[model samples]
Target: MSGYLTTHILDTARGLPAEGINIALFKIENGERQKIAETVTNSDGRTNAPILPAEAFEVGQYELVFFCGEYLENHGLTGGNLKFLDDIPIRFGMDDPAAHYHVPLLLSPYGYSTYRGS
Candidate 1:
């Protein structure tokens, strides 16, 4: 099997990649979140290593929590008390064990979106 996982973040509002951002991956079971992986983004808005290695990859539900508040602030964005978004949680499920999973987040201070990539 060659299953694995990867992710990246882009700051749409600033037209730059989101670096220095922290992301945590959690496995969900019975409505509970158990931390599985955590890392900070590199200069390219992606971790240097795979989020989930093939040896540990499995079919299950997972949640990715992205800390975007500090990132926005670092990029000179300030919303004081009216920020529309901060910590963003994206939930997804995996059922295939032999495929590659790339989840990329396109973001701004107020909103974000994601899609599966090759």
Candidate 2:
């Protein structure tokens, strides 16, 4: 198998996949940030393609910023009424380039959680 990065977003409050949300992937080098790729979620709450394909995989610090606030607003949730979590930034690292890294976000308006998935 080859190494790559993938992601998923689940709207825990609605108990459904978060469709049409934007996600950006970035590579960090020397305290500076570089945009690697960006994609929007499909109906399945996943990007149409891998954020980082195997051939383009690299070893370094990375960040996945989710447009959670916009998504919440689009879903008809008033941000002014409930504002806690927005534009969630999840930073992680990858040292190996031959293993699959699945980063899934379980999200809510007030809080969220992520982990290095299988």
Candidate 3:
């Protein structure tokens, strides 16, 4: 079995899936960021497909940039010019090539949390 990367966002404040949020996946190499994939969250707060599919998966450092600011603004949760939680970047490493990588974000207007999920 080959590993792939998947993610989702839950609005902690509203207790619902965050929809229409933009997410960008980047593979980091030698301190440089290379964008690999980009997608928007559906009604279920998940992408239709894995951001990093098995065939393209590799063991390395990666980052997921979640455009939380735009989502918050759309939902009327913005804080004027500077929002506390804007673009949330979760940087992690995938060490196993045959394991599923499920990174889920629990998000609120002022805070967020994430973990390796099943």
Which candidate wins on TM-score? 3
Please identify model 3 stretches exceeding 4 Å from their true place. none
Give the 10-residue window scoring lowest on summed lDDT in candidate 2.
76-85
TM-score for model 2?
0.93
The sequence of per-residue lDDT tens digits that candidate 3 reaches over residues 89-115 is: 999999999999999999999899999
- For residues 22-102, could you state the per-residue lDDT of candidate 2 as single tens digits? 999999999998998999999999999899999899878999999888788777664576656778889999998788999
| TM-score against truth, every candidate | 0.94, 0.93, 0.96
How many Å off is the CA of 112 in candidate 3? 0.2
| Every model: Cα RMSD to truth | 1.1, 1.4, 0.9
lDDT, each prediction: 0.88, 0.89, 0.94
Of models 1 and 3, which has the larger lDDT?
A: 3
lDDT of 2 at 52: 94
Ordering by lDDT: 3, 2, 1
Candidate 1, residues 1-118: lDDT per residue as tens digits? 7799999999888888899999999999999999999999999999898898898898899999998888787666747755567789999998899989988899987789999887
Query: What is candidate 2's local distance difference test score?
Result: 0.89
